[model samples]
Target chain A: MLILSRRKDETIIIDDKIEISIVDIKGDQVKLGINAPRSVKIYRKEVYLEIEKENAAAARSSDALASLGDLFKK
Target chain B: MDNDVKQISIPSGLYGFEGLTKFALTRASQEPFLLLKSLEEESLSFILIDPLYFRPDYTPDLSDEDLKEIGEEKENNLYALAIVTVRPGEDPQMTANLQGPIIINGDTLTARQCITSNPKWQTRHDILAEIRSHQGAESC
Candidate 1:
């Protein structure tokens, strides 16, 4: 991981397409403004990880879904 | 290869299963639950549920970028299916991932698991409890 120090209002450009700007800085929280192509998907690291973890757990329980058939009686 | 199988292509795939772009959507033995079987890996599959079936007010606020990626506009023939997770034991518990719903475009059959910006949604929503609560409200 390349770590670079940037103060507020500083911007980092990736591949000359994606731009990540440091919008605001409070004591601990740092707000970011990202400009990227529509194809690029942006997400918070923790939110993305949570979805990944949930997907993995859901995949593992596929066989157990048969038991749930009784719950939905329509 | 079944006639009932609907081919779905997720260019970016799911959060964890990124390499798997192709999948087959088929109805499970259950009425509402659907099976999302990976075409690349035979052993991998997931049970999907239409969140709106239980949570009638479920409206995932999809970003324009996410919609464009799937070649769709907001709510234009889009089917949002939540991945179901079943916890087995003496009393089995089931939950659905509402935070990241698998959004499929009906026309093109393209799909993507989109993460909503709403903090109210979460990875695990108690399916049975939600149903019971709905039933409890109806009786009043």
Candidate 2:
């Protein structure tokens, strides 16, 4: 990852459509503000990773369909 | 949990949105969608979604027991549905919200979105693959 240092009110531009700004820095926590188009989605890294893991797990479960079929057998 | 079978119509399409309904072409030929039908009528129109499509970071709310029942490992099932695709040429793909899921009361039919503990069910699933395989031997 490209790491950069910036003070409050500074900003980073991406793909001409998204802008990330440094809002404040308190202790170890740094507050940020993001600007992007409505169609674009932004999320935390951990959250994204968690969801990706879930998506992979769900995709692997062939039994779900089988169970649903079992539900119909009754 | 009452299973009083009723001939409820699924709007012939998902929520009757003209654009989204176009996808329902594939679903029409598929078998009756055997969902965990809600007891309430209002919660009838629901879809499961994939969390990665929306907020890749989501956690569900489920007890240890509920987790076992749904066959999940944690209290991390929750998501919402913005849109679902039911096409004729493609698989009937319904996106599930990994952040939230449509939960219905089988007895009252009153549905509410619930977070599942199961990490195995996506918000969106393609029903076409299942349908294709189920077709008669000649079609295959």
Candidate 3:
């Protein structure tokens, strides 16, 4: 992992298109401001990983799905 | 038939499977749950549900940046679909991954899964339980 030290309002440019800046820092929480091309998508690393794990788990056979029997009755 | 399949491009793909760009939305055995299948790999597919159908209260906020990312001007154009996780032979229950919903642009047909700002929705939301909860309240 590449770590860089930047104070509030400091910005980092990537590929000359994407710009990430530290908007504010208060105690443990840090606010970031990102400016990138419309094509670029951003997400939290932990949240992305959680979705990926669920996606993989959902990728099961149709037979397995049907064989699971019925959902709980009312 | 080939005409039945809905072709879509996932610019960022789904989390771990970012390499796959071309995908097909095919009908699943279950109603309201479509199969998000990868055209490149026959074995790759996921059960997807429009979370709104089950949880109408769910309206995740879409930022201006997120809208532009998918080439959308209106927030409504970005369709939200939640991935459904099913465990076979044991609990036999289905859960929707509400933490991050997949948003697709109607015009561009490009999709990307994004995290919701609303913390109420979690990674696993029980569909049947939600239905029952709503149904139970309606009786009162």
Candidate 4:
């Protein structure tokens, strides 16, 4: 892992396209501003991890489709 | 190529099952459940359900980048299916993952699991409870 110490208002450029800037810092919270192309998809780390975990659990679901079919019947 | 199965290619693949990109999508032996079976692996599969079936106003609020990734033009031929999680037990409880829905382009057969920023959407939503509540409301 690459580690660099940057202060507020400092910006880091990646691949000559994406830019990450330290927008604000107060106490334990720090705000970041990212500038990337439209093709780039960015997400909060925890949110992404939660989705990944849920997908894994969904894949392990039991073969209970037959039992649940009646629930949809009107 | 089974007559009922539709081949879908997810270039980026699902988050945890990233390597298994090719999938055979077919309706389960049920009214509203669909089975997404991975072509790369036999044991891997997911049961899907249209979120709107339970949550009538399930607007995922997909981002522009998400739409572009799936090649969605004017939102035509796009379908969003939520992955269902069915717990194993005597009385199984089922939940749907609405936060990250599998968006498929019917015309191109390309799909991607997209995450929504909406606070109302979550990874697990009780399917039975939702339906029961709706039924109670309708009866009134």
Candidate 5:
């Protein structure tokens, strides 16, 4: 991992296309502003993980398949 | 064989799976999770699918003009959809997006996922995985 230290208002450029800026800093909290193309998708890590979890959960239930198998077999 | 069984007809268009009789999801320690299952129809097959398989960021593409035609607010109201796959044996197979979650006006069943900003759905999910799981279970 490439780690760098910078103060507020400072910016970092990635691949010449994406930019990350430190917008504000408070005790134990820092706000970041990201500048990326529309093609780039940005999502909170927690939100993404939550969605994935729900999708997997909904799929695991066997009620749908059990009913279908019974239908076709008869 | 008696010929008194009534034939059921499933609509050709996409439909929401509000009450599927059976469905299951499989978790692989190293591989992607799989959803598989069957429906209540005798000749119809339902495939359990993971929404992530279709679109990582599944947003409906809609223009401002399109929203006006339906009298819908762009940000406040949008449609989502999911796809489901069905088959009737080793012949022709059909798949539907069970993600996107086709949004419809509560008052009207007219539905479409052609546009929306929701990114929590998928376009395609496989069915064969579910069949294998069920078959494997029955053998044991």
Candidate 6:
């Protein structure tokens, strides 16, 4: 992992397109501000991973989903 | 299998299936659930539902970047859907990921799965239990 120390208000540019800045730091929590192109999509690491897991589970035609056809109407 | 298949383009191509872009959004037999069938991969399909249906207070304020990503200007023009997760059993449990809501632009047919900033929302929420719990409160 590439570790770089940056103080508050310090900015890091990626590919000259996306910019990440440290907005504030207090205790163990740090607030960040990201500036990227509209084409670039950003998400929290935990939220992104959760969505990926949910999407993977939804891809298959599970017995639970398959049986849902009769569950809702009933 | 019939008509009413709306072509939706997920620019980000969702979380897991990032490669697959084109999809067909059609109504399922039930009113609450919709079928998100992928055109590229025939087997790739998912059951979708509006998270708001389960949680009326679920108001996910999309960031400006989220709106631009889907080419949507007004937030009202965007339709949101969550991929349903069902557990297999005699009394199967179904949940919706309110944390990450899929935003779609009706005019442009562009869509994006965006993470909500709301602290109240969760990745997996019990859809059936939520409805039933609300029903009891309403009757009281």
Q: Top DockQ: which candidate number?
A: 1
Clashes of each: 0, 38, 0, 0, 35, 0
Higher-ranked by DockQ: 3 or 6: 6
iRMSD of all candidate structures: 2.0, 12.5, 3.2, 2.0, 11.7, 2.9
After superposition, candidate 5 runs with Cα above 4 Å error: A62-74, B1-80, B83-140
Q: Every model's Cα RMSD, please?
A: 3.4, 14.5, 4.4, 3.0, 15.7, 4.0
Summed over model 1, clashes come to 0
Q: What is candidate 2's TM-score against the reference?
A: 0.35
Provide the overall lDDT of each model, using Cα atoms, as 2-decimal numbers. 0.89, 0.40, 0.77, 0.86, 0.43, 0.81
- What's the CA error at residue B82 for candidate 1, in Å? 0.5
**Taking the tens digit of each residue's C-alpha lDDT, what string does model 1 give over B1-140?**
23388999999999999999999999988767899999999999999999988788899988877778788564457989999999888777789999999999888889989998788889999987888898899899
In model 1, the clashing pairs are none
Which pairs clash in the backbone of model 3? none
TM-score of each: 0.83, 0.35, 0.75, 0.85, 0.37, 0.78
Positional deviation of B128 in candidate 6, in angstroms?
0.6
- What's model 4's TM-score? 0.85
TM-score-wise, the better of 1 and 6 is 1
Against the native chain B, each candidate's TM-score is 0.93, 0.32, 0.89, 0.92, 0.32, 0.91
Q: How does chain A of every candidate compare to the true chain A by TM-score?
A: 0.84, 0.66, 0.77, 0.85, 0.76, 0.78
For residues A1-74, what per-residue lDDT tens digits would candidate 5 score against the true structure? Answer: 99999999999999899999999999989999999876555655654344344334444332244444443343
* First chain of candidate 6, TM-score: 0.78
Question: Candidate 1, residues A2-74: lDDT per residue as tens digits?
Answer: 9999999999999999999999999999999999987676778999999999999999999987788765552
* Winner by DockQ between candidate 4 and candidate 1: 1
Q: What fraction of native interface contacts does model 3 preserve?
A: 0.48
* Tens digit of per-residue lDDT, candidate 3, span A1-74: 98899999999999999999999999999999999986676767887678778777777644455543345332
Measured with C-alpha atoms, the lDDT of residue B4 in candidate 5 is 27
Candidate 5 whole-model C-alpha lDDT, 0 to 1: 0.43
Candidate 6 is graded, for docking, as acceptable
Ranking of all predicted structures according to TM-score, beginning with the best and ending with the worst: 4, 1, 6, 3, 5, 2
CA deviation > 4 Å runs, candidate 3: A2-44, A61-63, A67-69, A72-74, B1-3
